[model samples]
Target: MSMKLLAGSLIAAALTLAWGSPGLAGPARPLLLAQASQSAEDIFWQSVQNSTDPAMFQAYLDQVANGTFKGVYKPLAEIKLRALGKTAAPATPAPETTAQDRTTPPPATEPATPPPTQTAQDAASSPDIEACDRAAAHAMDDQKPANLPGVTFDKLDTSAAITACLRATKLADAPSREFFQLGRSYDKAGNYKEAMVAYKAAMEKGHKRAIYNVATGLMKTQRGVKKDPAAALALMERAVDEKVMFALSGLGDYYRLGVGGRRNYPKAIDYYNQAIAAGDSQGYVGLAIMTYDGTGIPRNRNKACDLWQKGSSLGDSNAADYSKRYCRYR
Candidate 1:
């Protein structure tokens, strides 16, 4: 299926529950309200118990937003959001900054020679590199969600990760994925120059996420790399074609922020929605910021709150902060 059609189907599937009827009525209102109140309490505590999983918190917000229950748990939800990431901002900015300080890309360099693929047989013959993978794995890795725990860029322990990844890279059975993780470690550690080298190495081995990282470097014009928004956007388009989920959101940001020297609100919204459909919660955060600011979209504080609430539920701290700061429920 095409990306757009696929996105539409996925979006429809995601909203299936959201669009369902609550089944409240005059005769059953009292009993239903009591049931809903209990359900809300149960869900809120459940989210608190599994605070590590943002989806739990999102469930509670979903209930409240959909009118299944009163928003009594909102305050506690805000607390959870704060604990998960940075403190809430005092006020909303006009345009949310797309520049990620921790994961900024470095200059492109000579590509590393591709190593032999680490097949299952090779891995079985060598010492397990699970420790290195655990230390350096990134949340944005398209291949990691099912096999490993992914850490956010800001949350990474760069020192430990870098050491593990460096050791992993020296192994004869090391694969392209290790180099990508090593680049992520360096980027998070603010060693963009080294990060670029590792990313190029990963790229030479056909690591798709490395392409996104290189494109980001070109977009941000930091890390000793010359600015090339056009090149960055082109690379992102290619990454999207290669099924890199992060590239979907990255494209949304580019159009949203005029990174390519021209803002395209319609294109931005399309990309953001597509990203959200693809299960990238950052898409919700970007769209919510645009909604809050009324930039190329109708200004709807409530809609923005709903968007942030969804993004927060998906483990985005920035989304949680925005929802906390702006999603005031009466």
Candidate 2:
């Protein structure tokens, strides 16, 4: 009997040591089940946290409905409440209390109250519209093209400036000077298309400089219109008629080169003479070449030599070479 009692005490001590002590051989079954439950809950929470869209969340909820979760699958609202550090009860719906025992009044069946009507001044001064207007003005002022000295017309960025300028002129009701300035800006920005449009608008407003610019620009690029050399010739002729010396020289070149129409040597010589009379050294060289080669007039070596000497003195390279090679009195 004493040996049996000793055996029973030993069995009880072994069972206590195996189940309760850290030095035990293996985990208790209940402890293993609890760990598994916690791990499953962690996986569920991870799925919820990683879900980016409603579809993914619904898929995860379906997994819970199919009993894929080893532990309890809490309601999403309860999860949210827990995330907010609130004490959340289980989602099992409570039994409905008796109506007489309810403290809060029932929701009204009537429609909601309408908002107050705004006055005309209040409507006009709406913050959203005012903010939009201010933003648009800021964009206009910020994006308008600026001029820089020494920057060539071919190197400018005109697309953004043209867009902003057009917006400012149309929406902001800018002045004629604004349109003219925008056209000049477009010209400087290398946007001939926008420049032509802007110049036309300015011309409609009676801007004379804009008219000159449009004519010159069309002459330069032949934008929209066909490349009419006669039109170009006529435009330069007008400038010449207005006593523009450079225009006279250009007309002489045009006639000499037969640019617009038939090559009229006499007309070329006549224009060259006019340019020379206007005291242009390049024009003198042009006339000297014509006389030296019997191109537009009778060959006169003496006159050629005199013109060459005059042009050479004024820094004309061709005339200087001619004076050195053919006009040197040896």
Candidate 3:
């Protein structure tokens, strides 16, 4: 887990269940973070012992932004790290200016690589590809509910936020999570090549989340990446070890499809169960499909119907469509 993530979870855990109660205008919210602690144990105690206050942690994070840990506080921001772009890194680092920060800007330029089986032109024109891309982008949209927890458009003020993000990550003392954030920024800007650089750097620094994300990007054939199921599966497994639910679902998909490995229906079922235990909706849909097909497990229409109903309730469109075909409306 990233230190930034640990910090946020720790702070939220510090909240008084009875928030907005008397004496909580601001000051009485949380303050132990006002003073940095000596040890990791104390740090946890200090964080959880205080009230829920993002500002306190934000200030604490700012002060330690360039500290030894390279801690960053963003949660679920890295995404869409496509492999369809430039082959070369920039000659120099971007200036510490806010304006150049990552945003949903226009495509700066396309890489010079020759068109593949599926060119950008083709992808743009193909309704299926366009819809898939839209779904991907929509998942990361900060504006509405994707029904995916721990994900949000936390950096709405792109310029200032990216400035802070870059400044923090640029410090020789900065954490790998900072680079993960940088990759997310670049990904948001549609700079897939640059995003990959940041992801690689984060992975080098042992960021499991970055490994997970790079793996997902590699698996997206529509993203112009050469398929590397084995490599992607390996990375997802690593992230799953860190107890990331996203990685668990990824493993389920990889196992079911035999991507980067042999088709193991049983393993896929297990991974999907793990994700479902972690409250991920994707698991319900995956498990439902496999049960319906009877690929690995016995075909049980009743069980599959029940799973599809659960998944559809969780907002999985595929499960909803499948329900219409194979099972009566729930």
Report the Cα RMSD per candidate.
26.3, 28.9, 21.4
Best by lDDT: 1
Order the candidate numbers by TM-score, best to worst: 1, 3, 2
- List residue ranges in candidate 1 displaced over 4 A: 1-125, 139-147
Q: What is the TM-score of each candidate against the true structure?
A: 0.58, 0.35, 0.47
* Native-to-model Cα distance after best TM-score fit, residue 198 in candidate 2, in Å: 6.0
Please, what are the lDDT tens digits per residue for candidate 3 over residues 1-330? Answer: 444566556544433321222354544443343332233323433453232333334434443454522332222121101111212232455577466555547677977887456444443345433222222222422321244332233433343334445444544444555566666665765546556767789789876677877887777553224567778888888888876556888899999998887899889999999988987777888898888788798988789899878978978777788888889743
lDDT of each: 0.71, 0.55, 0.59
Q: Which model, 2 or 3, shows the larger lDDT?
A: 3
Candidate 3 or 1, higher lDDT: 1
- List candidate 2 segments past 4 Å from native: 1-226, 288-294, 298-330
Residue 195 in model 2: shift from native, Å? 5.0
Best by TM-score: 1
Candidate 2 weakest lDDT stretch, 10 residues? 135-144
Worst 10 residues of 1 by lDDT: 26-35
Q: Candidate 3: global Cα-lDDT?
A: 0.59
